[model samples]
Target: MNSFWAVFKRELKSYFTTPLAYVFLVIFLFFSGYLTFKEGFYEARQADLKPFFVNLPLLFVFMVPSTAMRLWAEERKVGSVELLFTLPITIVQAVLAKFFAAWLFLGIALALTFPLVVTVCYLGNPDIGLIVTGYLGAFLMAGGFLAIGCFFSALSKNQVIAFVLSVVACAVLVFAGMPTTLNYVSTFLPPGMVAAVEGMSFQVHFDSMQRGILQFQDLAYFVLLIAGWVAACAIVLDERKAS
Candidate 1:
């Protein structure tokens, strides 16, 4: 626990000490708002953040990876991974601490968009329950993406390679949940297989939560997905240590 906190504090502080955190926040906030108002038709739509929520998964495809690309990549790049291993903490603890730090930073960035909630409430009566659920889904989805990013970051010594690989990997998951992707798959695959693929989509689970329907299965999918990737990260670290 002590070692976890130590790494958490160091990694979280590292985000702010450099320009990365600020740049990411600014870019995210700007694009989120732009997409919501311009593409989302915020003025024309009813008192709902549906458009914002709709765009979030796509935004996360790029943004979360950018934030996570440095987790272990930078450590290896500068040879600080050796120092990290020298600590009393186990590899799993370090992995969780770093993952949580990045995840929490994403939470902070998401929370900063609260003014959107405020604006929607001020405009008219909105389903507060639905809005809250949407944010919850977004946060969970971000964690899932971050976990994938962390896995790839641990695998690569170059940050750019980590970012690119994370983006590609996350993009597949994101697109898999889309109706278009599923439709394309259905043309080639049988109905049963198509349904299975659709069920595996991050967007499918996220869309359910976005609608204020918090199914246990949807929640479990994100939890298990994150756990799986984090475990993979630990394995990669172990292999590197062995090598």
Candidate 2:
């Protein structure tokens, strides 16, 4: 527990010390506001945040990866991963600590968007339940993206490589919903298997949350996605230790 907290603190501080936090905040705030207005707030004749939530996964593809690209890659680049091993902590502890720090950073960015929620409230009698659930969906979706980023970050010593890999992984997750990808997946599969393949996408799961319906299965999908990536990261890093 102590070791986890120590790694968490160190990782959190590292985020603030770089250009990542500032750049992402600027991009996220600008794009979100731009989309909110462009989508026509009160004039759109709808209280739904369809415009806002639609572009969410797109924003996360870049921003979330940017935050996580350096978590472990930077350490490996500087030959400091050995120093981490020299500590009295296990690889899982380090992975969780860094993972949690990245997750918290994503949460903070999402929280900072509260004014958008307030604006929606003031504009109309929007469903607060929907807004709350949408935010939850966004947060969980971001976690899934970040976990994939963390995996790529641990797999390489080059931060740029990690960034590109994270982007690709996240892109595939989002793009699984595209007609081409879905068709391809369904080609050789049975009805139930096709359904299951399409269901593996983050888009399907997140859309359910954005609509204010919190299904246990959607929530489980997110939890399992994050857990799978984090577990893969730990396993790969463990191999790095042996090597």
Candidate 3:
């Protein structure tokens, strides 16, 4: 536990020390606000952040990868992986610590958008329960994307390659649950198969939470997906260390 906190604190501090974190935060907030007010029709919509939640998954497909691209790729690129391995911490601790650090950084960025929540409340009586659930879903989805990015990061020494691969992989998950994709598959595939594919989509689960339904299955999907990817990352790292 102490080792985990050590790595977590170091990684989290590194984010603030570097300009990447700041730049990412600024870009995210700018686009989030712009999309909510301009594209989301915030002025005209009911007192809710539906539009913002609707755009989050797509935005995360790009933003979250950029944040995670450096988790392990940078370590390998700079020959620091050896140093990491020599430390007192186990690989699992190291992986979880870094994952939590990046995840928390994203959480802080999301929290900074509280002004939107304040605006909605002032405008009309909004369902606070729904709004809270939306944020919960967003956070969980962010972790899933980050875990995917972290796995890809472990596979490459170049940060750009990690970022690109993460984006492509995450994009597929985001679109898999879309109506258009399922519709295309339904033309040839059986209904069961199409339904199976849709069930695997991150969007499908997230949309449920966006509508204020916090089913255990939806939450479990994200949790299990994240664990799977993180476990994959640990395996990759261990193999890389051996070879």
Q: On residues 1-243, what C-alpha lDDT tens digit does candidate 1 reach at each position?
A: 599999999999999999999999999999999888876455565888898999999999999999999999888888888888997989999999999999999999999999888888888888999999999999999999999999999898889999999999999988987989998999999999988888888999999999999999999999999999999999997787433
- Candidate 1 regions off by >4 Å? 241-243
Whose lDDT is greatest here? Answer: 3
| Ordering by TM-score | 3, 1, 2
Model 2 over residues 22-73: C-alpha lDDT tens digits?
8888788888778777856667777667678888889899889988888888
Q: How many backbone clashes does candidate 3 have?
A: 0
Listed in order, each prediction's TM-score against the native is: 0.97, 0.93, 0.97
Worst 10 residues of 2 by lDDT: 39-48
Per-residue lDDT of model 3, residues 20-139, tens digit only: 889999999999988888764555669999988999998999999999999999998888889988989899999999999999999999998899999899989999999999999999
Instruction: Name the TM-score of candidate 1.
Output: 0.97
Selected candidate, larger lDDT, 2 vs 3 = 3
